[model samples]
Target: MIWPFNRKTSTETGAEYYIRDAAIADAKTLVDFKHRIWRDMFGHLKDEAFFTQAEATTDEQVKFWQSRISRGDTVWMAEDLRDRLVGTLHATTKHSEHTAEFVAAHALGELHELRYFYLTAATAETTIGTELIRTAIGDQPAITWLMGHAPLVETNLRQAGFEPLGEPIDPSDAPWKGIPRQAMVRQ
Candidate 1:
């Protein structure tokens, strides 16, 4: 059963888990989740000091989330039965095709950018990832283009009908750091 796209609580799990468009009030949670997940997952890629120095917080992430959500973008969360948010996935509609260096040059102009979706380590397999992606791209079934950072879990997405495109791209401008991201398109 699909929950309301604007609410975050779920009835069956009593976990308050739901995928809905994020709001300004969700900023702190979003930021905390991002930081926590990063420390938990990407700690080996770079120094934990960077994240600390970056001073990234839920309020900041929320501000960005609020801006995007306010502009037709959506962010989904996986909360516990106790209403504690555990993970998040952020997706936005791109007006223009996003060109990634790894994409076949010929296919660049033909794709739509279903950008940015992530799940917390603890909430990774709770079906939150699949649910969030479905919420974002389900209705527009024909627009079969999406991408994200998850080489380790590519198979899960593949099973869901998303095929890996090419190598992943760096989500930031920092030249010293890079993450292994995987891209997918509908087959």
Candidate 2:
């Protein structure tokens, strides 16, 4: 569904942008955006072999996003006035089993995961990201979790009422292994 409060002006360009529910056609664009943002953020920290592996997963990413959108997860996209997809956000009740355990252990009721929330560098300073996150959260008082890597995202989440859940963990088993990531919760 299109969010009613999504319209905003970019601070950098003063161009209008809107956030709305993503469609199946957005899968490819989302994947491309994901690649761009991922590389921009982590490229210098990773090896060519890692990037090659990421390149090989394009189809998988497309399918994964498509399935999420089709399954009625809260997937929203921010588009410029020209209708170019510039950013995306996704939230869902579905999370890793370990995440569920974490929720239960903390007594966070029916938590939802902020699975993906990203903006292209050009649009990163706009209010669009905040609005998208608010749209996903709505009136739900339950806990929500987000893994924060970048300082901007962490600051935004904190400003939006999330707090660090615990110490940062080293993602030793994943790509960008050894990179410290913090788990945050909105409660």
State TM-scores per candidate.
0.68, 0.81
Checking candidate 2 for backbone clashes, the offending pairs are: none
- Candidate lDDT scores, in order, read 0.55, 0.71
RMSD score of candidate 2 (Å): 5.8
Residues 1-187, model 1: lDDT tens digits = 9855534455665544666666767766777766666665566776767777655454565678778767766667666656666656554434333344434463544344454445555564566666666776663321223322343234445655676566555566552346544456663
Question: How does model 1 score by TM-score?
Answer: 0.68
| Predicted candidate 2 versus true structure: per-residue lDDT over 1-187, tens digit per residue | 8855444544455657878898888888888887777666666677778778987999999899889788876588888866787777777777777678777777887766776677776566777766777888764543443442355565666767778787666666777575565667876
Which 10-residue window of candidate 1 scores lowest in summed lDDT? 139-148
**Candidate 2 lDDT score relative to the true structure:** 0.71
Counting clashing residue pairs in each candidate, in order, gives 6, 0
**What are the C-alpha RMSDs, in order, of all predicted structures?**
6.4, 5.8
Runs in model 2 lying further than 4 Å from the true structure:
1-15, 139-149
